[model samples]
Target: MFNIPASNIAHIIQLAVAPVFLLAGIGGILNVVATRLARVVDRVRSLERDLPEADPDQLEVGMRELAILDRRMGVCHWSIALSTVAALLICLVVMILFITDLVALNFAIPVSLLFIAAMVSLTLGLSLFLFEVTIATRFVRVDEQYIMRRRLL
Candidate 1:
């Protein structure tokens, strides 16, 4: 049997559960951000591929769209990086929980700090994702598309 008492181990597991859940949530966020990044990249590549055949006026529009896509891609990348860091910090917190229990040491302060840092990182990542979404909506030619559809109809 492990040197730590079963009750102590159980307590540590209980304490670790919340952080583990947080890690899973972070993972989900990362997945969404990664997918967004992939889509942005694909769009950029498609625009670039078509640029050469574009008329002068169309080329200008394509370039502007490419710039916006570039910004979105950068935002997605940062969101993913920060979320990943948060996930790693959470993993460390869980590891420390087990270590502290086994050694019977006071690690409450460090654990709390790590958890806070992870939250901060996740918040920033989520904020960036929001910003990217905003940019996507802001630059979209919704009115133009609507008019075009109406005319076709």
Candidate 2:
């Protein structure tokens, strides 16, 4: 039911092109985040499966690692969710642009707000991703934890 004016169609498409690029970038981020999320999940699951049979001497260390992985999973999950929301908002912005032209409706404010919100979501998501990566790297070695514990004491 798009009765978009022929004269306005080109302009609308041109305006929407920018958001289309945003959507593409968000999709790329989501893909990379999802892949990393999958790997984290697999490792967490493997650790859990092996925990019961873990050497008694190493059980505590294994459990501690598992806890860190769980936190990472939560962070990763929200990062993915936020990225998805940002992508959806970008999609809505593109749709609003076309709808604005088709119905001669004022959508500038809505479009701007949606675009801004999408950007904020992406920013927050990426920040959390960075935090998760930092945490992931921090505990990579057994000796690192002892050093961190000493610093905290």
Candidate 3:
């Protein structure tokens, strides 16, 4: 109802601020994960398009790289999913903050649990991002020219 005190409302707003900031951070993470996923898809499409014209050795190397890219694409997908879940959980935390203030019910346990789950989900998503990057760097083939130049140094 409309009987809630202004000071209580202000306090609720104060409680909500942290979760809102957490939501913004999650949004940024989602953007990066989505961009990586798109890039991986683009690379996969490009490789598929050129596969028919590739010579045998080129085809073999391309196929191998394509497999690695495919794994990267999957990892990016899972990371995005988990990051999205975290963002959604943070949103729930914010809403629950307001609801608890308005209805005068204790939601502290639920809010704490939600925030913890959000952090766990975000951590797992970031770990997957790190794993994806590791896989990508592992398969990166330095140009022979670059290696020869380094050797000359």
Q: Please name the candidate that would achieve the greatest TM-score relative to the true structure.
A: 3
Count of clashing residue pairs in every prediction: 0, 0, 0
Ranking by lDDT: 3, 1, 2
Which candidate would rank higher by TM-score, 2 or 3?
A: 3
All-Cα superposition RMSD per candidate: 2.2, 5.3, 1.4
lDDT of 2 by residue, 1-153 (tens): 466567688898899898899888888988888888899899988888888998986789788988998898899999999999999999999998888778888978998999999999999999988988998898885677799999999
Q: Is candidate 1 or candidate 2 better by TM-score?
A: 1
Per-residue CA lDDT of model 3 for 49-127, tens digit only, reads 9999999999999999899999999999999999999999999999999998899899999999999999999999999
Query: TM-scores, in order shown?
Result: 0.91, 0.87, 0.94
What lDDT score belongs to each candidate, Candidate 1 first? 0.92, 0.88, 0.92
Regions of model 3 farther than 4 Å from truth: 150-153
lDDT of 1 by residue, 1-153 (tens): 366678888998999899888988988999999999999999999999999999999999999999999999999999999999899999999999999888878999999999899989999999999999999999985678789999999
- Candidate 1 is scored at a TM of 0.91
Specify the poorest-scoring 10-residue window by lDDT in model 2: 1-10
lDDT-superior candidate, 2 or 3: 3
**Model 2 CA deviation exceeding 4 Å by range:** 1-5, 142-153
